[model samples]
Target: MIWQLDLILCLFIIICAIAAINVKDLLGAVIILGAYSFFMCLLWTEMGAVDVAFTEASVGAGVGTVLFIAAVSKTKRRSKD
Candidate 1:
């Protein structure tokens, strides 16, 4: 049962990762990346790595996502293409 849950979380993480990479909009991609990081943090927590999970949540999902949004806000919303 635990292994199954782990597998499911892993699958979600992979899906989020692919979505983040394939997304064309910078803001959307960054948000997807943040979701991916959040999933990773959940997986780490489930695996008993609370410290690592906390760091991933705080640094990867939290601060990193905010930074990306700030950077995106300063640029044009849509690309020239």
Candidate 2:
């Protein structure tokens, strides 16, 4: 495993996490979090953890994103701050 590639993916994952947390729009945050999950899945696959990556891709990036979007769509979408 190349440490450089791993570092890059880890950086991207951290960036996505921070962006997801800071984003004002609910949908945008959800999208960013989904992206974060995708990066995490990539890292897992790169590390030879294929099963973990598959689960993360299907559950975190897939169903979790869909569920978050659905919930956000049903909300008032207002933030106190």
Candidate 3:
């Protein structure tokens, strides 16, 4: 069961990463990146690294997503150059 869950999480992370790169909207890409981070945190937890998972969840999924969205908001949604 644990291995199955880990496999699922890995697959989810991969899908989120692809979505993050392919999404046309900057905000959507940022959101997908956050989802990828969340799956990574889950993978860490499955690997018996609770502390690392907590840190990833807090920094990667939380603070990082906020920063990305803030940076995106500061510029135009679509870049001409």
Give, for candidate 3, the lowest lDDT window spanning 10 residues: 72-81
Query: Largest lDDT belongs to which candidate?
Result: 2
Local distance difference test, per candidate?
0.91, 0.91, 0.88
How many residue pairs of model 2 clash at the backbone?
Answer: 0
Across residues 1-81, which tens digit of lDDT does each residue of candidate 2 receive?
789999999999999999988878878888999999999999999999999999999998999999999999999565443
Q: For residues 1-81, could you state the per-residue lDDT of candidate 1 as single tens digits? A: 289889999999999998887777888888999999999999999999999999999999999999999999998655442
TM-score of each: 0.89, 0.94, 0.91
Give lDDT for model 1: 0.91
> In candidate 1, which residue ranges exceed 4 Å CA deviation?
79-81
Give the number of the best model, judged by TM-score.
2
Question: Any residue pairs clashing in model 3, and if so which?
Answer: none
40, model 1: CA deviation in Å? 0.3
Off by over 4 Å in 2: none
